[model samples]
Target: MILAIDTATKWTGLALYDGRTLLAETGWHSTNTHTVELAPSVDELLRRTGIQATDLAAVAVAIGPGSYTGLRIGLGFAKGLALANQTRLIGVPTLDIVAASQTYSEGQLVAIAEAGRSRVCAGLYQWRGKKGWQSQEPPIIDSWQNLLDSLDGPVIFAGEINPAAAKLIRAAGKSFQIANAMNSARRAGYLAEIGWQRLRRGWVDDPATLAPIYLRNPAETSA
Candidate 1:
């Protein structure tokens, strides 16, 4: 079984996946309460699924370009659980998790997560029939204008894009579609599926070396 957690923002999500199916999943949009609620939520999920920590083969978490406190809380919990259970821990980039939600798109895929101020953490991806979505540029923290200037063609935009950002995307003179915001929040089942794929390919990372991808320093302002 694979246990997945996402505390990348105000919303925290948890899920238990047994390779072939999702056993249980739950989430709450309580950013300020993660410190107190995360553990109980995890316990509730496991209880509902009748799975113990030691029964999990691995743990997956969203390592992010998100709220620093949220990332640390989620990662710390995941790492501790993995250590206690002697299971592998996997950290998936927040942007990649957002992109995975739109894996069925045939054209270019752009996953953008609100990065506070007027900037966003964005990644460009292209779907290949057999290879799946290939990232065009690694996730970067930048203004919506910068993202617009760099676009070459029609693209699908996914994640929590604001109205202003949406207008800019439309003005780029390219076909664009907004994916569901919930899809961007981090789906535990999807995280587990993706983690399983990476594990099979030997793409595991050392828990000690894993760190959240805060593309730009929190103190810096984007123009």
Candidate 2:
């Protein structure tokens, strides 16, 4: 079995996969309640699916470039579970999970997710068989305008795009395409799918040293 968790932002997600099939999945936006919500959600999911932690052959988690607190909570929990169960662990970039969730079948894509304080996390990706979107670059944090100016032409913009950023992107004319709302929702089934593939191919990460892809200085987040 494969268990995947994504707490890359306000959206909290989990999914269970049984090697050949997705058994169950869940996702919701929390009100700064991930610390309280995540574990219960996982427990309920496993109870509903009758999956035990010891049954997890591997676990996949979305490591950040996202909320400082959210990233820490998710990775810390995932590592504890993996270590406890002696299961394989893999850390997928949050944006990579964003890209994976989309149905963009072709062409270049710019997957963006929210970064706190009037900015966004951005990455470059392209469609590929099985993997859906393959990373062209790791995710980075920048203002939406800077990201728009840097693009050469039309590209699919997906993820939880800021409304102001969405408007600015649309104002760029026909060159920028926004993904449908459903496509923009980040779901962890895709994360499980990606992780299962990696598990089969022997691509896994060491939980002892894995860290969130924090693109901004921690000092910037001090309140």
Candidate 3:
């Protein structure tokens, strides 16, 4: 069994997956409560699914270009769990989780997460047949206007998009398609699936050396 955890932003998600089956999954908009709520939520999922900590063969977590405290809380928890349980640890990028949640599309897909202070951490992506969406480049922190201005052709946008960003996309006209709320909301279920694939291929991270990806200095970040 593999456990997936995502607390990369205000949104937090968790899931229990075992290659062929997704036993349980849950996600919610957590208004700065990740530290307090994450552990209990994981416990509840395990209880409901009748899985013990030892049953987890691997632990997958979203290592982020996200909220400073949020990334630290999630990664710290995941690392501790992996160390104590002696399970493999996998670190999936936060934006990749967003991209993984999206279905295949013909052209470009932009995955984004709120970076606060009027900016977002976004990555450009392209669909790969069986592998799904793959990032074209490393994610960058930028304002919505600059991001939109950089896109020329028809593109699909996914991940956490606030009202103001939505407005800009709408005014930018028909070249863009904003993924619906359901598709855009990052889910740990997809994160688990991705991790399962990696685990099968013997891909895992060292709990001792793995670290969160921060696009901005933690001290300077507002989120």
- TM-score of each model, in listed order: 0.89, 0.93, 0.97
lDDT of each: 0.79, 0.85, 0.92
User: What's the distance in Å from true for residue 144, model 1?
Assistant: 1.9
The digit string of per-residue lDDT tens for model 3 on 45-104 reads 999999999999999999998999999999999999999999999999999999987887
Report RMSD (Å) for each prediction in the order shown.
Answer: 2.6, 1.8, 1.0
- Tens-digit lDDT track of model 2 for 1-223: 9999988888889999987888999999888888899999999999999889999999999987788888889999999999999999998888877787677544688888778787888999988876577888767888877888888665898898867878999998757888888888878998898899889999999998999888888667411
- The lDDT, on a scale of 0 to 1, for candidate 3 is 0.92
Task: State the lDDT of candidate 1 residue by residue for 1-223, as single tens digits.
Answer: 8888988766677888877888888877774677899998899888887888889889999988777777878999999998889889999987777777775765688887667677787888888777677777678878888887877666788877767877887777866667766655556677788888887777877888888877766555221
Q: List the residue pairs that clash in candidate 1.
A: none
Order by TM-score, highest first: 3, 2, 1
Q: Which ten residues in a row have the lowest lDDT in candidate 1?
A: 214-223
- Provide the lDDT at 16 for model 2: 98
lDDT of 1 at 113: 66
Off by over 4 Å in 2: 104-106, 128-131
**193 Cα displacement, candidate 3 (Å):** 0.4
